[model samples]
Target chain A: MFALILPAVLVVAALLVGPMVLLARISLNQYSATQLMIEATTAQNYLNAVADPYYRGVMLTTLVMAFICTALTLALGFPAAYRLARMESRWKSLVTVLTLIPLLVGNVVRAAGWLGLLGNDGLINATLRGLGLTSEPLRLVYTPGAVAVGTIAVVLPYMILTLSSVIESIPRAVEEAAANLGASAFTVFRRVVWPLALPGTVAGCVLVFILCMNTYATAVLLGGSQFKMMAPAVYDQFSKGMNWPFGAALAFILLAATLVLTVLGTALLGRRYAR
Target chain B: MGQVRAGPGPDTVTREAVTRMRAAPLSPLAAPALAGPGLSVRLGRLAFLAAVFLAYAIVFAPIVMVVVTSFFDQEIVTFPPDGLTIRWYLNAWAQRDFARGFLTSLQIALAATAIGVPLGTAAALALVRATIPGRGFINTVLLAPLAVPAIVAGSALYMFYLRAEDWLDMDIKATLGGLVAANVLITIPWTVRLVTASLAGLDRAAEEAAANLGARPLTVFTRITLPMLRPGIVAAALFSFVASFENLELNLLLVGPGRTTLPVAMLSYLEFRMDPTLAAVATAQILMVTILMLVTDRFVKLSRIV
Candidate 1:
């Protein structure tokens, strides 16, 4: 096992962890991007990140947005997943294919597409206006809502695919057995299949939750500078903001948060299902 | 592959069609004998599926619109233009560095897949086939890369490349090799997971039998396991290749001067000007993605690969 995966392990370690420690070191150092040189170590950058209220807001908003998105995905996802799992006709395969098509499109294209869809003179607003639904173009573009919409669209596929596969695994005999013993479809579903598929649902929810938390593209494209998220803030601090130590601190903190979620999710979901 | 025994069970007509199946098999034909999802709850689910379909339509509308808007020569962003024209496609095609950018992206993506897929498969085989100590811990640690946001990944790559240049006193950032190095790291998990799943479900008997029969391990592997693993490796390589091609975030951070992938170039252009021509470029990208998704889906089932 070790030998087969040795090369992949090395590459990931060198690219992922090596740079993380390097960034940590750079973050601690009085790094100079201009001269491209670093002075000896200092704690100033870390202090700036923790002390600043602006950075605080960024972290808070990111966490809040991630959770909100996760909740929205679950709420919207459950019914669709249930329907897909119970699908009749030859359409089940088509539906499965349809759900996955979105994954093929890159984030850049997806974000750009949303810009057109939600812009002031975009089709959505135009349709709304034509229907006399509103007087003015409701600040649809460049809002937190737009960010949520884009994020949901991108992440929805993962949620649906994961949840549906789990749902499909529920044996019909168990449901029939429940119904045979004087249970309705709903009762049988609630009592049996729901519990059976809970692992997949939980896994999907956990994955979505973490991806949303780690997200940067949707935030950058939809929220812009004002509607901050944790990942993008970490990004700006390193790139445009030009504060290495603070950025590194934020990155470490974000990494820590994701790790916590993964552990909790595994304990809560994976170990129980044991699939 | 998962198999479903078509037709209803214990039927003279349906059973004649097939011996056995899995899941609720489709009736040989839609007949009065068949029942839909329960009538009481059936409407509810149908309505829900309809709503989901509408949502899917909304999600897909942008790509559809881009394809429509791409043909516009109006030069301005508008829905109902003067008339549909194909001039924008020509302009997009002839645009400076756009062709070069496309070639660069293709080259980088191909090179990255060449390195990444085999390494990932090797990793998967090692992790799954061997009784290595701490294999689970090592696999999780390796996949931890995906948990990091692309921005951080890009930043790390940029910084590393910069330092490498400093140490070697040679340019490394703008080169194809640098792009491959960054993308290979990003795409490894996909190939590893795909190959590992394939390996896990694989028939080990052929190789074992071959070894006993006096065929060398290498010969057995080439004849038996490699043929079986080909579907998975191809699918993984294709998926990783497409991803590498369209990767904007990492490229945005690490793509050095004088050479930019198509996506990074489009992003830079859009940062300054948003035009219908960009839509043309976007349409071309969508076309590539459509083909890629089909190819990958055919070779490897997404559910199993992950």
Candidate 2:
């Protein structure tokens, strides 16, 4: 049994763990423009990342945006998930396929789709002009709003899938029983469904929140070049600035932030619902 | 049916019973009106259905926009007055970068899937069948990559490759093999997840029976366990291929000149031009993935695994 698992263990250790350890080491090194990177032990990279106002603002923006997207996704996805979970119509399978189609399409492609819709001459503007509702394009594309919308669209399916699977297991009989006992529909949801689906909600929110924080292509394409996020900032440091140490530090910061927030959120939710 | 005779039965009646009562052929008037939902409930249901419809519309709007833009005859995509044409697709095909990138992506996805699936299957089998300690810990470790941000993984791998190049005095970064290795890392987690789920559903009695009948362990695995795991293995391969093909952030840092994958090529193209040619490219990709998923679902029921 151990032998059967050795090949995978070796690959993961050598590729994943080895790289991560090397990255941590590199993050402590010093970056010099002439020599690229110098071997040294220093806290300068992390200190610079933390102290710089620009980087601090970018981290904050990423956090807020991630929170907003997660909230919006939950708001929009829960009803759809409940509908799908309890669907008895013949169209259930067709609806499921439709829900899944966007997920299979990559984020880059989806962002491109948003580009065509929200651009100056794109669908939304064209429709607005045709309707005589506005004189100008309204600056829909290349805005923060566009980034949020695109990110929500990309992650919504994931939330729906996660929540629906959990909701499906909750058994319709329970909800019906609550209703039979004269509990209002909202009451049934508050007292029954909400607590039952808390675990899935947490899982979905964490997953979507992580994706939003690390969003690269959507932020780059839809938010335009001026808009900065943690992932793209990390990319720019390595690709354009050629600052490996700083880039490694930024990557670690993003990873740590995501991990800490996810753990904290899960713990808080778990504790609150434990009663 | 016997409970239908109880007084004020609306509280006890199941939804299916009401539906059946409404659908009964012999007595249309016998269907109880009181069992149906009240007017407010009906209105609320209508509102919920509309909300669901709107949600689906938002989810699909961008993808539909891309496909629509791809058919526009104009060079620049302007909505609501363009004639239809397939010229953008032809133009996309003529672009050497997209062509080369598509082939490169296909090869990488294939290589990654081919290698990652078997290794993941073995690990999953060991974890499921063997009474190993710390099984939960090992499972978490295997799935950890899925949780890590792709950009972080890509940067880490890029830096690690550079260090390895220095130590081995050999070029590893910015090569086809290096790119494939990165892709394989991402694919393994999906394979492990799907195959593990599959193994959990499988009955071990056949394997135990074969062992008791004096068949070698290898023979039992090959003839019994592997065959039962066929659907899972196939699903794993399909998903892994899609994952590798669609990957952008991981390949963004690892790709070199002339070794760019399709998503990277598409990104660079978007940076340069906002024409419908990219839309045509994306539409082609969307169609291919949809068809592949539909076909795979025909055999494996993707809803079960995904």
| TM-scores computed on chain B for all candidates | 0.83, 0.87
lDDT of 2 at A195: 89
- Which 10 consecutive residues of model 2 chain B have the lowest summed lDDT? B1-10
Candidate 2 lDDT tens digits, B1-306: 000111122233565564465433211111112457677766766776677777777788889888888999889888774699998898998999999999999999999999999999999989998999888888777777787799998999998888788899987876878888988887888899888888888998999999999999889989999999998888888888998999999989989897899999999888766778999999999998888777767656655565
Give one digit per residue, the lDDT tens place, for model 1 in B203-302.
Answer: 8888898889999878987888789899989888888888788877776667766788988777666554556778888888898877777777777765
DockQ for every prediction shown: 0.35, 0.42
RMSD of 1: 5.0
Native-referenced TM-scores of chain A, all candidate models: 0.86, 0.97
Interface RMSD values for the candidates, listed in order?
A: 5.8, 8.1
Cα lDDT of model 2 by residue, A9-104, tens digit:
778777888898889999999999899999999999999999999999999989999999999999888888888766656576666666776887
Top candidate when judged by DockQ against the true structure: 2
Clashes of 2: 0
Q: Which stretches of candidate 2 lie over 4 Å from their true place?
A: A89-94, B1-43
TM-score of chain B of 1: 0.83
Q: Indicate the residue-level lDDT of B305 in model 2.
A: 61
